[model samples]
Target: MTRQSRAHLTDRGAPTSRPVSGPADHPVPATARFRTFRVAAFALIVLVIGGAAIGLVVTRLLGPGATDVAAIQVHASMGGFDPPALTVKAGQPVKIEFASMDSSMHTDGGGWHQFAIDALGINWKVGPLASEVFEFTAPATAGSYSWYCDICCGGKANPQMQGTLTVTG
Candidate 1:
């Protein structure tokens, strides 16, 4: 090609004075951009405050160490309930927290344990390595009920896995 032809070919792709940058290249005035930034900052502040309020509400409603009522802790494992028994007054509302210690991967309900009783209508099944809290009202009749871990470790037949919930007047 001739020298003039080469020069024309190179000049065809040269850049112009118009910037190729983002939003800055848009011809909006400084005041308009500042207003957009102010709006975004205000929205962020509102979101943060709203999130903090929600968190505080949730913490107050479900946080541990409830002091208003009688509470008891019951732990479960491959062996049995920690105390192997529990006692409560008839018709009294009680909080029972069940904590599962071991993860039973080889059993039917893997890593899960249960405290079930048909008489008092209580059946609490907890996931492996986790804990759960529930409320219960003792039977008004006042008698002994069989509670057992009928999951993973063994059924009610296993003496070690069974316990008695004795309700008294």
Candidate 2:
């Protein structure tokens, strides 16, 4: 075969310069690029919205701010309040945040658990799966005062549901 013919026909008689298209030959148009960007932006917005929803749910489940006025958290269940003992300075401002861990009882009317310190004239109640805050001033007289839950489990009579509050001068 002549050199020119040999160059044009591979031993198999196939053309060397077959027509083919690459990415550069078919450039993406401005509108298509904009649509792609819009889709990506929409996906990002969805992700952010979903994340925020999850955050709100988690926050609700975990409970709200720890911030308070002389905040103290007391939990009450069938077994009664945990940390039955508390201490404070005489005449000091005090705040108790009460939460009922009891799921068995309904709290639509206040709650099943009541915290009362007769001497301090403080009485507060919270229902199942609920919380409440109480603010008071410690008794002026420095002494050990009794506190108790007056509800389902028992009152001041039930040792398990009763606690002490000590006021120091």
Candidate 3:
């Protein structure tokens, strides 16, 4: 092809400026284009973060309602509840295992390892052994109940050896 023909051919399929281009290529300035991109990016980030937070909250809400309760075992002399608190079903058997280092209180013979679930109307006593099982329907209400070492025989004055029972129906 001739040089002129080649030049025409090259420009044929290309976008050409007017005899004199306008102020700029775009009606909206380049800065506006950049601002739009930044805004979109920020919106995407917010959506992602918000979705993650919502998912966490939903998972926690739909998770298991409650499970077996536990206690934090502490020496009678030291005086503190093992685990401190626990949760259990309203109509389920209860088990408390005590582990005490107060040889004087829990003599080899048999002292008192009493347990009280006042909410469930359960107040029973056991022995020096660190384990006992009580079969009774827990209180049919969901609330907090306090159980303490009634036998101040716990080597101290009202030792803070107390725990909470969270009963849920």
lDDT of 1 by residue, 115-167 (tens): 89987678898886667888887777788888888876457778878888899
lDDT of 1: 0.72
Q: Rank the candidates by TM-score, best first.
A: 2, 1, 3
Give the per-residue lDDT digits (tens) of candidate 3, residues 20-67.
Answer: 234343333446667999999999999999999998667433322223
Off by over 4 Å in 1: 1-70, 104-108
Q: Please report, in order, the local distance difference test score of every candidate based on alpha carbons.
A: 0.72, 0.71, 0.53
> Lowest-scoring 10 consecutive residues by lDDT in candidate 1?
60-69
Ranking by lDDT: 1, 2, 3
Task: Provide the lDDT at 152 for model 3.
Answer: 43
**Shift in Å, residue 71, candidate 1:** 2.9
Across residues 1-169, which tens digit of lDDT does each residue of candidate 2 receive?
A: 4544544343334344744344342233435667999999999999999999998667544533444545798877666667788899999898888877655334422336888888778888876566788889888889998878867644567887788889999
Q: How high is the lDDT of residue 34 in model 2?
A: 78
TM-score of each: 0.56, 0.56, 0.41
The pairs that clash in candidate 1 are: none
Collision count of model 3: 6
Better of 1 and 3 by TM-score: 1
